[model samples]
Target: MTSSITDVAGIEVGHFTDARRPTGCTVVLARGSAVAGVDVRGAAPGTRETDLLAPQNVVERVHAVLLSGGSAWGLDAAGGVMRWLEEQGIGIDVGPARIPIVPAAVLFDLPLGDQRVRPDAAAGYAACQAASRSAPAEGCIGAGAGAVVGKIFGFHRAMKGGIGTASVTAGGVTVGALIACNALGDVVDPDTGRVIAGARTEDGLHLLDSRRALLRGDAPRPMLAGSNTTIGVIATDAVLTKVQASRLATVGHDGLARSINPVHTLSDGDALFALATGASGRTPGMMTLAAMAAEACALAVVRAVRAARGVRIGELHLPAAGEI
Candidate 1:
């Protein structure tokens, strides 16, 4: 009867944060046996567990998945998850030794609030330990701690972006999504359809029309080379094979499109993963169910932006949803 995706069974999430360092990570673990798949649509995605997700990959089950800050450097955090899984005796065959498959992905967050701080291996393990059967915290925490958006014109004009999640259930199948929103477009209110966060002019006003800004030759704005991405995970309790899960992940991108404007840009890395815990066998239409899941995920992205608190970077103000 719950409206959110946490209604799915045996899917748990946890967050580990360091406010002083201003960086953290989150872990999503399948409480029971589950099949998972991933789809990377972005050109600059940074992932470590992708090989394990492919159909051709030898590994079957992923003990845990990590989403963290530190850009490419944060990728090392998987080592900590691996270490913990090894202690638990997970992973494919390797003689008497066991290697835990902990797939992880990260986004670039070095420029939003702090540059020196990054998510480390210990942080990853801490997050994994915190996974539980509660609704995961959203906005300005974990992998989204340093996220920002609307930086196509540079950070000075950008707005604060963070983590968001939403879920939906139909025909006894539940689908949930968790997203770290760090993109080049503005976040909008899904209900009212208004720009809630994004770039602003010096006079303190929104672009009014984002497409116009891209078309107008008003003034050539300096752009950051690689400082954007939105990554997320979608989980369902429907029985699905790895290939079907991967296809579902791709379908989840529709949620991204509904929440963010001008998504999947060259400067942005947008990726989504779909995980299936075999708790339901009520066979539903695959494409129809996937579309509904995507819609719910998109709503969650909007909620994430609405929940963010403003972050100050130098003299410029990175406004929150209300301010935008």
Candidate 2:
């Protein structure tokens, strides 16, 4: 098990990272259309076509789901995904042309990257062209390229955060998750109840509990006004109604709540999408899927932090600057 979202039969993962600019995008393309639903938990989410994914909406399936950097501005990447799907003769037949349904969400990675040079349509297209079924290149790549976490102590003390993914199969069902771990709060391991990576102490050593910092009412949130977010997608092989898929997304938030301290706040945009291919029989019930989803989500967060390499802050790497 490569333990990536691609473990699901039809899903393929790809990344287009602009290393020089410290920004990029990731695309999760389904070989065939998949039933999709989304849940937005953060107070400042930047999304596209999310409404269409609702149970009552007209769209039934999506060709691809994009998670990108550049915040709201990066939404244009979805246009490129649409173009790619159209060229492949995918999407709903609307007579003259097939309209590929694609939904996307973005995180604020501007603080670490060359904010002016953000992901664009061309970058998105490149990502699709690069799609593959192999294990996705995690860490500081794709939308996670410029991702930073634990900024409650401000930019100087934050740690590098990036993309992480995990997948599992049990009781004849397979579930997977891909996450871009950028947030305003600390990341805690649910199993250990320990702060793995987050705001650092003044000496640049030891993890500081940003949640406690907030409770003290002394922490000045870095780049407040929606400067942080975490976005990603989850995939399963089970069959589910749009409503069930939506609920899957909601329960998936428990993963974030367990892994990210003080999450879904006014300064963070945390969103997760659920896609079901129904490629297998003997699917588990919704509650079971939700529990597994939460586990995958939490594990993915830890993986993202472990895989990430610190970005430069002045003359020092962000991680080293706060090395405890």
Candidate 3:
């Protein structure tokens, strides 16, 4: 009943928040090595070891999944996760040595805070050291620390984005999601169909409603490609094959679409990872698990924005959902 990703039996969450800047990493550790799958929907993505997650791949499980800030450079964090897992004698026994399988994704948080600073190997190692079965701290922490959304209008009108988690259970099966909301569009409440956090008007006094703006012939601000993304992980305790796990990840994106406006755009590197611990030993229907996974993911996306606090670095300040 933690209402977090840790609600899954074999999942452990950890984070490393850098004091020097608003950038860091989050690690989801399945020390027992859970069956993993991935779906990358965005045109721009920074990831590592995702190809191995394909159903036809040889590796069926991953020791950890890393979500990080610092864009492409953040992929370095996965190396640290590998080192830590190896230290714990975790990973696939390859006869001579055990090589840990760690899949990772990164979002762009460079425009906020200090762009010069980014997560590295040490940061990833520190996150592993902090891993635990407890519900993790959310909002303006870890990879979500420097996250900002509503970039369609530009960062000046964007709101603070952060980490959030939620879980759902049905028929003795449990599904959970950990979302780091950092999209190039606005976040909406699927239940209410209201814009909760996103771009602001010219005066920065109201929501610009990016979708509407685009419909009205307002072009998004020009920016470099691969500058925004929403990355996350979905965990479930249901027994599943590699294909099912991959399907779960794909269905999980439906949650993001329900909650985020104009998602999977060329500018957003949205990626989701699905990890099945199979601790429950129950093989539920695909439809049931899919529904639970999407629900959990949408809930987590909303929570990420709501729990976030306004961030002020230098003269620029990005407000949180509640503030607006």
Candidate 4:
């Protein structure tokens, strides 16, 4: 019970954080490769190799999944992951070479950090070197280091977001989620239906409740397309086909909908990747797996905002959930 995605067998987690700025990348490695699929729910997304995960694609497995900061430029980090996996002799064995399939997604964090210092190939390799079966460090680290949420009002009023993980076991199978939440809307507690972290009021002393503001006709501050996003991975030990894995990823969005108000908006790029290692060798009921996926994803999302630490860079300040 590490309560982490690592709790799922055959899954390893790692991070590479840049001290120069609050931007980095997280890698979910399945060295042995695993059946993988993805669902991109938001209108704007920055990703690589996602099409290969489609059911009709030739590739049926992936060596690693990457969640990163620095927007689209961060996609370069995937190259490093491939390099590391190749060194381990892990990947699809084609006639000519063994190519590691590394799919990746990136979120917008350019404004909070030194945009020029985005995660590069070397950074990805470093993250792979740091990979471990141990529970990963959460909040204000890795890809979520510079994450911010509740931007409907504007960045100045937004709160800090971060990476979080949660796992659930049912019928001898385990499902887990690791989320880097950087949304354009507020985070809400699913149980209480209450806003936990979001845009601040005019005084910057209270939660503005983005959902309520929308209903009350508060004109939201306009944001550039693809300026925010929530990216994550869902892993399970149960046996699943590529189609099932994709469905799991799609249902995983229900978890996001439950905890994040006004999610899947045009300004946010929300994506989830599902990996089934089949370490348990159990073909559990699809309904059971889907329920667990959503539950774990929701828990991880809430934890992300709660575990986050406030950010203060010069005049810019993004408070953690508890800070207010």
Candidate 5:
């Protein structure tokens, strides 16, 4: 409903958080009849109900979509979403009971915050029940609360990253993007082509130069596991099948390329999802709309970085992009 992604209709977003623990989840819901699809391009994406995204899957309606913090462990939050939907009498019917089908995804945030912190079923249910007709909140909330980027070398050289969103309208169809900006690369200003935030040297006077560092024979090789990942969802009002929705998700990654440098790395669990609210049956031009969606997603990622607040990790001040 917001102008950001005004082309997508009848899509609602809700967020649940534990500020003390610095972790949470965001839920996106299609209040009415909608077609949804997903695309996972990363080598290490954590997701649920992926089978439902296949064209062959007979189930057409997804009661809720969940994005949460807690790495793979956070997947349990979907149980809460299921419980909420079940209470609302939604989902597939079997005999006298209805089972809720909530597709969910997660980003690795456990190492960034209180290691003991996690998102649970209660949080998921709260997010689903809180879905609203307003713009989604950006930065340091939901699954993005503990997200970070530009840590190709190590956490000492990382920068804070979070959630961002944008929307566009073309040919009367609307596409909106919501992104968790966690990556293994620097965030650049797409408009000016300047590094706004990224890894820094121990002295903090120079950039880490990740590519150069990697090529250096003298540089110590850092473990490439569990650094960061960017996950996103693109919602539209276009009436498309699950197959088309999957393609749109892939197309949406162009937005990530425009905003983040050295994206989709082995350490990055980048994933994108595309959904259709099925509010508009008119077929809009695909290529043009895809391009616009990418641009909007890029901008949304930048906004997420800018919106983050500083956090003290060890002895260093991990400043958020906009905080500086």
Candidate 6:
């Protein structure tokens, strides 16, 4: 068991990062296409081709999903993904050419990284080119490269967030999640309900609870529009319709709520995509798969923090688990 999203057969993972800018993109690919669904919980979301994923929509599957940083501008990564897929002759055949169905989501990392640098077509293509089924390199990579948590207390007090992945096999089926942990609230351990990664005091010595700070009416720093978002993708080999896949994406949010305190706020764009490869002809049930997917998501959240590395962002340095 690789314990990663790629563990789900028929799916591959890849990343393209700009270390200097502290921004990047992650690509989840299904060369043969995969049934896909998406759920967006946060008020501010930066996405591409999400409407088609709705059960009521026409597109039933997507060839790839892109998770990127750069706010709306990062969406250009999807075009790159499309170009790559088109070159490979992947997509819906509509007469003369095939149009690859690629959906995408983005997070806010500009406040923490080089605001001038953002993911683009080249980055998306690079990520697709690097697609593989091996266990992904977690933390401070891909879209999570510039991610930060506990932003409620403000950027100065926030902790570094990054990409994390988890997977589990149950009832002869595999469920997995790839999480980019970037929220306006604190990250808590679901089991203990204790703050694991969150805002630090102005003195940079102790962890501060976001809810507590808000309750006490202590505001730290403010941000611009689209300054925060958390995005991810959940995958399974079970056979499920678009509606079922969409429902599973909802369940995946439970995993986010478990690990991140006060999720789905107006400030954070919390979103997840559900992909069913249908490689396994058998499944315990949609509910069972959803529950497992939720758990896997929570696991990915913690792994991201644990695997993160300290990132220096102008005057401030956000420490990872080891540094903290």
Candidate 2 lDDT by residue in tens digits, 1-324: 458888888899989998668889999998588889999998889999899988998787888999999988889888888888889999998998899888999988776646888888888999999999898988899998988888877777788899999987789888899999888888888897788788888777778788776778864656675689988899998988888888878878899999999789888889999998888854689879999888888888888888888767566467721244
List model 4 lDDT by residue over 160-235, tens digit each: 9999999999999999999999999999999998999999998899999988898999999947989999999999
Q: Which stretches of candidate 5 lie over 4 Å from their true place?
A: 1-7, 205-224, 314-316
Candidate 3, clashing residue pairs? none
Looking at model 6, report the run of 10 residues with the lowest lDDT sum. Answer: 219-228
Worst lDDT 10-window in candidate 1: 217-226
Worst 10 residues of 5 by lDDT: 217-226
Ranking by TM-score: 4, 3, 6, 2, 1, 5
Alpha carbon lDDT at 54, candidate 6: 91
Candidate with better TM-score, 1 vs 6: 6
RMSD of 5: 2.4
RMSD to truth, every model: 2.2, 1.7, 0.9, 0.8, 2.4, 1.4
**Each model's total of backbone clashes:** 1, 6, 0, 0, 4, 0
**Model 1 spans > 4 angstroms off:** 1-5, 90-95, 190-193, 217-222
- The pairs that clash in candidate 6 are none
Candidate 3 lDDT tens digits, 134-207? 99998899989988888888889999999999999999989999999999989999998789999999889899
Hey, what RMSD does candidate 3 come out at?
0.9
For candidate 3, the per-residue lDDT at 154 reads 81
Model 2: CA > 4 A from native:
320-323
Better lDDT candidate (1, 6):
6
Over 1-324, each residue of candidate 6 has an lDDT whose tens digit, in order, gives: 549999999999999999678899999999988999999999889998888899998889899999999898999999999999999999998898899999999999887756889999999999999999999899999999988887776688788999999998998999999999988878888899888888888887888777687788886564554677789999999999999999999999999999998689878888999999999887679779978999999999988888888877569878766455
Q: List the residue pairs that clash in candidate 4.
A: none
